[model samples]
Target: MKQQIKHQYAGQYSQLSTKDFNYIKDHLSWELLAAKKCAHYAQESQDPQLATLINQIGLMHQRHYNTLLQYVNPQSVQD
Candidate 1:
């Protein structure tokens, strides 16, 4: 009998495919770039308010990166 593929928002699966890994990799790359850019601009800004906003943006991106990273390696949660 042939198996079926089920799509879900959240669930545990026995395995992940190469395409899934590649998608995660691409998203991680984008998050990294966004974080770096926000940080760099935040440092370069002269206005205090703008700097604060940029810093917040950077933090958000960093959080996203961390979340994605955790998804990539669930074992790290124990560390």
Candidate 2:
């Protein structure tokens, strides 16, 4: 029989190995770049509806970036 490892909630001081840190950093960079590009496209768009949709997409990416940052340094997030 195979055994499954249970997962637990990570705290502020939870250790992240170097490889995990590198992977998270790479993902954060991509998310930030995607958000920037989406925002730029939204600003350049002439159609109101399209601009609004793109802006929402940008906001989603921004939120993902912020969440990842908080995970990286949980102590820094106040709320």
Candidate 3:
């Protein structure tokens, strides 16, 4: 039989419902993908200012990704 993994979220409740968990997982993926896409476009950009702006946008997405990751697995998160 396949095993199921459980998650505990921070705040008032320790556990998330299946729907909420799935949403978080999906959101996490979206954030990571956005970050990667931004980075790729930034590298492909020839304009210095545009590249910088894209890089900054990528950083924002990356930060959101990481924060969501921490919530999903706080134990693995490093200081």
Candidate 4:
């Protein structure tokens, strides 16, 4: 039997006023949630490939978030 894991987005990006920021935040949240759900299924099936794919998706979300943040605040790019 495989254990089930509940994944959640506990981070807050609502305070950001930029539209791009909000867009990225929402998509990132969705991606993370989906990845978490996939992870649960993968664990139940003991599929290493599925687990790796989920991890890659999570990383992509993180990358997208970072790229959006850079677009929102170019000034921060230098810091």
Candidate 5:
């Protein structure tokens, strides 16, 4: 499957901070990659739950990204 909207937004989220930004950036990248891999494996292995779990992890990364963004810019979070 092609990349999702959340994956496409990774770059925008990557620019939020200098400290730990790279780590977050790398993590998001990895999560998307992992999600794809999990999807492939789930398809090959016929395990729907694995794909579901991978998507859940992807959502967690998005939530984490949003939390960090709010932390880095509280004003933006309020508005």
Candidate 6:
């Protein structure tokens, strides 16, 4: 039988393949960029309600990043 990873990751406890590492790395970058974009738009928006909504979305993205961070430390990856 061949060993296969069943999940992208649950936390740092599981083993990660090279593909998993790459996927996580790319997604982390994307999530961070999304969070930053949300923050910027929220700051720039003239409407208070819109700004609040954007802020909420940004916070959600930030939370996702933090969650994904549990998979692997960014510093551990080397190109």
List pairs with backbone clashes in candidate 6.
none
Per-residue lDDT of candidate 2, residues 1-79 (tens digit): 3333222226324556676777888999999999999999999999999999999999999899888877876555566
Which residue pairs show collisions in model 4? none
Give a tens-digit lDDT track for model 1, residues 1-79.
3343333323665445677767887998999999999999999999989999999999999888888877777555443
Number of the top lDDT candidate: 3
Full ranking by TM-score: 3, 2, 6, 1, 4, 5
Model 5: per-residue Cα lDDT over 1-79, one tens digit each = 3332232242354233343556665665675566566556655655578767765765665566566555444345443
Model 5 — which ten-residue stretch has the worst lDDT?
2-11
Writing each residue's lDDT as its tens digit, candidate 6 over 1-79 gives 4344544343444666667777888999999999999999999999999999999999999888887775566443333
Clashing pairs in 1: none
> What TM-score fits each model?
0.75, 0.78, 0.82, 0.42, 0.41, 0.75
lDDT of 3 by residue, 1-79 (tens): 4334566656433566677778899999999999999999999999999999999999999999989998888776677
Q: How many residue pairs clash per model?
A: 0, 0, 0, 0, 0, 0
Q: Can you tell me which runs of candidate 4 are displaced by over 4 Å?
A: 1-45, 75-79
Which regions of candidate 3 fall more than 4 Å away from where they truly are? 1-13
Clashing pairs in 2: none
| Alpha-carbon runs more than 4 Å astray in model 5 | 1-17, 46-79
* C-alpha lDDT values of all predictions: 0.79, 0.80, 0.86, 0.56, 0.54, 0.79
- Model 1 — TM-score against the truth? 0.75
Model 3 lDDT-worst window of ten = 1-10
lDDT, candidate 4, 1-79, per-residue tens:
3333222222423344355455756775775576566556656656788777766775666566555545544445444
**Model 3: per-residue Cα lDDT at residue 8:** 63
Off by over 4 Å in 6: 1-12, 74-79
